[model samples]
Target: MFFKWVMLSLLLSRSLASQQEEDVGFTYNGFRGVNMSLDGIAQITESGLLLLVSTTWAQVGHAFYPQPLHFMNSSRGNALSFSTTFVFAMFSELTTVGGPGIALVISPAKEFPGALPSSFLGLFNMATIGKPSNHLIGVELDTLQNEEFNDINGNHVGIDINDLKSVEAVPASYFSDQENRRIDLNLFGGQPMQLWVEYDGIEKQLNVTLAPINVPKPTIPLLSLKIDLSRYMVDPMFVGFSSSTSALDVSQYVLGWSFRMNGQAKDLSLSQLPKLPRRGTKTKPNFLKIGFPVFGASLVLMLVFIIQFIVRRRIKYAEVLEDWELEYGPHRFKYKDLYIATKGFNEKELLGIGGFGKVYRGMLPNSKEEVAVKRVSHDSRQGMREFIAEIISIGKLQHRSIVKLLGYCRRKGELLLVYDFMPNGSLDKFLFDHLSTTIKTKLSWNHRFQIIKSVASALLYLHEEWEQVVVHRDVKSSNVMLDKELNGRLGDFGLARLYDHGGDPKSTHVVGTFGYLAPELSRTGKASPCVDVFAFGVFLLEVACGRRPIEAGASEECHVLVEWVISSWSRGEILETVDPKLEMNYEVEEMELVLKLGLLCSQYIPTARPYMRQVVRYLDREIPLPELPSLSKSISLPSEMSTCGDISMWSPYYLGSTMSTSSSVADSLLSGGR
Candidate 1:
């Protein structure tokens, strides 16, 4: 019955299009005669429903009015008052979380060429989001919580201008006059809902109101913002709807739509609106519907279905596109690419294992370049976007003393970070594994001193020279990776933090290796450049003395490295603490200087520690070493030593990132408004 009615209306669409624009606006009562351009999975069903997308995994859909609409006055150069209303529904069959979201977009043209799917909402891609040339405005009815966008929750509405990050956002809710309270609306509840978007040129105000399809418009808007839309608007503009299915398998539809340029939009006729079809009913072909049942009756299809379910259940995590990442070029690697590179992460290709996860050596098929991939496991699902963002953020750092962060990959829920492969492995092997047959000879004292200096230079770059102050929360011999030249390049940044140069340092959980933690760090939980200095001091003592900060000894001798070094200096035999492995073949002056400087940097008071800049100068002999604070003043040492969990394995926020960017998910948007 409905199909015949729609077919009749489809014939009258051209004539009705002109007639429908009676009150300076157009109305799509049932979209039967609607002239809308559809792309991706969007189509007008036989039952007259405007279906946006199907259950495709990672895809985007767009539907726009056929002709451009005049949003601004040509003579006045000001945005004109306009209003729009639409009835929509989103359905998710297999997942509770429905979609990345849907957006009502005002764009310069009908097509968004480089737009991305998933969290980007198909309105913009990472590179295009904040460009002024975009001339875009989107009112997003977002259904999933994206840590990268600082969304309040999974269900909310936001106003985004030229950026995927919202300018203003709030939980999805509307004020009710009858109930005399606020009513929350679920965007992905699979029910029809009405939404109104209005803009006033004079007041420079934008308001959005939402309600159940059966209810009247809400008295108070769900989200109200004061903004001059003229900045994002041009004379001839196009309006449309955009949606992208995400981790959740969701289908979206529009039942009716109405719009006006200079006056109130025409009200949609509830009785005339298209009926939303049930899943697999009118949407799927009649032959396919019956074919599945026949196969199930014969038990073969049932067995196949059972086996597929079991396979999916065993996999544990789905291979969502965000898991592998979608951006092209050097910043990200597809999971399939990485898997093939590492030959399925074979045990034979294993490099080493650390606190975070396992590391594998692989060769890129295209470049034939050897790379090291670290498989890191994370506990939070909400923070993956921000995590990948930071991975891209820090991958930009380039320095001879710092290992390059190539990119990252996600596969079967495993998070993999890729880096430039260091052939010589870590510094700890040469320093601590001298007895191993492969390491028959010990590292010369000159090389040790040079390694110390190289590490100091890298620390200086991280602390004072880079665009942001980076605090390497974990600094030890193991993390100092050695390249082909045997030069020490600081590598592991899993626990590092990026902070503004002049800003107050934020508190972090006490995290780092067991013995390298600073005295003040354990108590205050604040991470800064000073704590890094303390850890570097421990590294100095470890390298020169051929021992760790805390060793297996009596309880009182727990912090033997600092105490033994200090006692040797007091007895006028500081050289005694030098590594026996060197056989005393080292510069006495340089060795003594390193021992005393280590003591100075490891002072109990954080203020007494030399900055990385000062440490660098002292190593270079750019300045004379200052007098010691007092051998009896006590060196910084933790009463108890135990490893803190690898923070790289933690949060969506509450986790940290590089400079000028919000370290937490609560404010993870890039630096820009709207």
Candidate 2:
């Protein structure tokens, strides 16, 4: 039992020793409140009060008074003070928020209990200080220098607190001019690490140590502290350190006092301390609330990217459509569709060659009827303008002499024109082929005269009748398609030019075969109806003399047919110039009339040439022939002339030897009426 009592006594002493650390307590009085997480705070009432405290930071190494340290929720002016030296020592010890600066300020209470010992209650200011230069043992307040505020050099100086009463001993010379006495206060270096205070009591004495680890030992002046008791007070007053200048910067700091009465300590652990609360404010902070603006920015960026992507996609689609139109719009045809129609463009169904591309015999789909197909080459010198001109001009054109255009196709950069297939083939084969009997048996003298008149009538219509006056810039005999009935049908319009009434037939670059080009093409650089008339003149001589424009072996005589005709007509030898095969099947008067008109149309000067209308009139006996000039000079064919814009085909199976002599091959080989 005695041993148990000893152990119980030892435990009680340990508890009392810990409680002595915070023996100074405070009383709150004001319009403030404290709401704690736990039941760890007190309420002030008129009857009595209970103290509650926090112990989160209570151990000696690094203790913190986690708070709700507030005044009581009452309207009267509230004052609180630390009432014990043990509490004041909490300020002197080290802390995380910084510490070791402490003080004491006491004031007499307005009302005290009659049965209790009345004492002063007040606040305090914790600060640091040093000793005076006069070798005084404690703080000296009177020796502090007082200077007037000035702005002579525009430098900042300390503000004067003259009206404030000095209630404690001001430590002498705390603000020293000595550079070695300055404190860096930086975390990494040596700091002026000491604590001192001004006492408000009449007794003024101070003791300081450099390193306080071993309290029984004392180190000299890295710094020191002093005081003066002359101006000490018993009222609520400020008691702290002051310097002549503001150079004292420390890392850890605190401001509170230790309570003492008759030199006796009190039990004031964290659990026994009063709580302090804070007042509320009106404004909220700006940095914490940003929800809507961030969402809005994200939405705007998404919309911009979407719009840009859509615009780029649309532009790419447009470019693709444009390229398709350029390639296939003119000739719309499917390869399979065309293949079935032409029997796969078979060689046995071949018709002839055309100026722009190739011609083949074909049959339309669904209806196995025969037709002539002309397909333009992709690399043909001509482009889409030429293709459209052939399609529109040939389809809408009308004349008993004009070839019938059925339909056309444009596919994959290939242009094809379908027409009524003429089985008799081309005029060149008959005119130049020895084996062809179409020329001898079919083209009689009367037929030759009628063919010339028919050709003249077609030229007149092209130059005058249509809404658009058509100039057959290339009017060669091959361009004229003749049916089995010997009817002349003008075909091929790749080089045709359109002219309105009252518009001049402007000469263009020479564009027809040699020997058919106009004499004035070189000097004038123009192509007109007169150019066609020149080609027609050659056509007339070909029918009359039965010879090619430029025969192979004739050489000087290779130009025989034209030379003979020009020479015979000039010397009045009409019978000799006429085709020998005609016999007496044609009239001399009609032959003479056509010969004169052909000569007039082929005049060197375009102005000297007669128009097709006049040629037609002379052939039909409606107009009289003008006085003729002697053909003194021979008319030679132009070596280089422009090609006519007509396209035609000749059956290559009936190829003949070169046509240089009429006797070697029958005149029946040639029979076109362009």
Candidate 3:
């Protein structure tokens, strides 16, 4: 009996000690409503803990547990393990892209004094980034790409050790049980997301799992890395979250958090946690109940005043909208209508993909008219500006050679533009489709000639016939759409600028595609009618030669189509530069005239290039082609003539790549018409 009692006592003591260790770390049922102990930049809100560095730019914010937790002393000794589960959300007040996301940081201090903003995630600055002494371990939930840090994309989770450079990373995604397929999660889409991070001390392994709060825990982890924390961590370290923003703003919220140390704890059942208190539910003075009748009368009066004020404001707003419609002439679309038309912007409906957003083909329910819907990414700095530019530049213009803007939609967090669908897609398809013999689509020489003339007429309308001089900065072959009759229609005026006649618009930023950028625009960072002419020169050459302005070649000179074409012309072998697919079917005289015209418009001097009116006349044979300049002289290339614009503001694919959608849609519907 004595021996049995001793054994029972030992068992009870071990059980009690294990339970005590489990309770060592913190657990909060609800961050805002619950009485949980914690620390760091956390704010009690109706929705829970709002974790933010600041409400403005170039700021860093963090939240951490008040007390430090024990870490492994050495690689050879017993180590402490931990498991943490939390629900967080990222949002933007301005309907902009929110980024430089949150990080689960383990550091020596709760406050990261030297933390940097933007892509640094408030973790490290320029001096200490990628250095060894930083001695920090972080599981970063990054929603913005920082090329300097080698980020995969805008939405990803990276394991960072002492640097912004990730040791291992994976895209933010969750397996949807309802859909039975993995769906890419937009971390900044204002949806609550759940995260699970675990560290195994014995194996020195780390695992991170993520999913939507409404979904079950995925069986597999998004990221798994074998790392020995003892090599980097101090004996006791602060563990919590840190986030920062620059230029772009995002709100971070922590609804609930629970953590355990020393081993795996029971999985948290977040569903049972108390819901956030409803707004206006806080305690009020008891005397308010005694004065109910008087208060009710005041409330009724206030409500009447509020309703009258709202009605007046709405009336004024509608009047302003009516005036705007009279001026712009672009129809305003209902958000719900466009959403339904585009099938909720499904990936399968995607037509053309560009840097700023994706173009989808949708059919309007009432009209049964097919339309190409351009959905600009909310996070894009240029998207909203481009959206405005497109409306101003294309909305009022009506021409047979210009893509017609049907309408636009702007809701709380989305901007969309709708255009008439072009059945034949973009001109690049005809120029490059010959590369694949399996596809029989080809543009005859006559069709190509008509396209050139039509595009020139469109330019003429913008520069001379329109009320304002609209300079299309990005006028590449991809921007030329082909209608059902294969007639060229100018499109994609996102980078266009409208200026008064004879006015030179001075823009601080240079925006255009590579190989097509005008030499003078690089030097001036200004847009003029001449800039469009220079791009037209490149486009003309591309269409005539059925080749890109720049192509992979053995020599640098050979890579530039202009230099190579000039060299061929000097050798009296200009025909060699013509597309082999033409098969000697085109008129030699017409081809030569067009080629010389292209060379004339692509002059090294911006002032030397012919205006859109002269280009139109030259194509129509109304004006004679000008004398060619000396081909022997070396051309001076512009120093700043490179790919411009923020690459993060673009989609992953090239502007005119083949779509993964069904072949029927690719053949019939307009794809890459941007």
Candidate 4:
């Protein structure tokens, strides 16, 4: 009797040690008025379904439980067992293409400010990504394979730590209870699917399972990762569903949700769950339902052959598909899709006609996401496999200030490259065209300064931060684009050459805009980071001085922009060269800084140029610019102002290989084009 009393007392104390929220759990058949905190594109539809994300371009949405749940034992400060299950359906206007999917997260806070949309899923932005400061754990239902995060496929489930890169992942599938075999599942299939997430704190194991709406919980989970959540979770953590869309438009819906602490979650009431909206036009007709088996075999075979011959004759669908490109299917666009998106290459959709090819404004089919498609004539001599592979590799780049290269398509006679559409167009139009017009669209000095830094940051990313060192042979104002928010995004990687870090780029024919080419290129056709720095220097001058590098003059003398800026600075009147369109509304110190930096970048000698990393530090004001005496020696400006912008100032200089703004690779394998 005394031993019984002692045991009872110990059990009671253990119960008391547990927090209140740990003993409480919640279940919702539908979220009509549930205590949910919603942000961004998240909302509750009138039908009582939780709509986390709708058909919006590049958006993020989060729906968190209003109160923080006790995730860890209060007395022991150790992670406690928990379970959650939710019914979700994701669909797109198109059949296969869907938005990047959602994550079930237990975050430290309900709101993540400055979180980037798209693949980041509103969890972290570029600056905060992969940082230990983000204390969160999640189970991700990712439909998009992000190479940057090392995702395995388009449909998978993963265990996320502080970052989106999963600690362990598996193809989204569930072991069928009836068949006792694994069956595949597509998260974006537009059919309601149920997901179960459970953690066993004692065993330090996490498991996630998925199945069709009516199926029983699988005995085996789709993904299981052994991780101690106590390392990242606190006593109280917020539980939420977070989703984000890319350029694609898709809707993510939660029909019903249930969660519990220290126990099994209540099963969602499927019968009472809200209905999912119909998706993807009319349901595709299953031809099997319309029996045609009665027809003779010969007749059926002949008809099929005729149909295939007709399709083969149609040039639009004649894609140059090679066996080598099979692995790149996820990154390749269907030719018919691009054709429909660009409205059969109609003139009405023409965004710009450059020397490379015509760029068309397009609304991608199904996603209805806007894109800019540039169609370049194909070169049969270049190996199509390597060419497409290189372009796809470039598409992997992710940065805020660089225009995104989405994907590419290859048809009968041309290669189509797709990019994110910038509504504000090229920066050169605002700088030069606005100079002669009464249109007040001229950029203020503040915008210009920010743009200079934005481009500099992007250049630094290409040169130092990326996996490979990329030398943008053409870094001119015309290549820079402006987003809707007036932020600068450097575009046009067509003329860019990439090499491994600490490796030298192979010598190639001079290929870039005329005035932007480095003088060393004429002597040694070698492309290097210094070559790009020289062009960036010229770009800075073009933005601040509002003049072309080489302008035609009345006599044999042509105006060289670099010399003009240097001469003005030499006379102690550098401010005289500032664009008058700025209305002198700029800071004197900043104006002097940009002009001098521009000079330092455009030094005639390759050894004199500062690396892109140093340039970014200077622009960001993290380091002080060197004084004039030393700065001048590195700059090594011309002895006299040149009447011409052409390198003809240096006698015997040959520029016979300089290509136009849009360089073509027809003659030289390294000639970069659209």
TM-score of each model, paired residue for residue: 0.48, 0.43, 0.50, 0.49
Order the candidates by TM-score, highest first — what do you get? 3, 4, 1, 2
Cα RMSD of predicted structure 2? 50.2
Choose 3 or 4, whichever is better by lDDT.
4
Which candidate comes out best when scored by lDDT? 4
lDDT of 2 by residue, 416-519 (tens): 67767776666555555645554454466676667777778888888778777777777767777667787666666656777676676665534455456665
What local distance difference test score does each model get?
A: 0.74, 0.43, 0.69, 0.77
Minimal lDDT window, size 10, model 2: 116-125
Clashes of each: 1, 44, 3, 2
Per-residue alpha-carbon lDDT of candidate 4 for residues 449-476, written as tens digits (9 for 90 to 100): 9999999999889888999987778888
Model 1 spans > 4 angstroms off? 1-329, 553-559, 631-674
lDDT of 4 at 122: 83
lDDT string for model 1 (418-474, tens) is: 899998888888887877786554578888899999999999888888888878888
Which candidate do you rate higher for lDDT, 1 or 4?
A: 4
Instruction: Give, for candidate 3, the lowest lDDT window spanning 10 residues.
Output: 665-674
lDDT of the structure predicted as candidate 3: 0.69
Model 2, global lDDT:
0.43
Candidate 1, residue 471: CA error in Å? 1.0
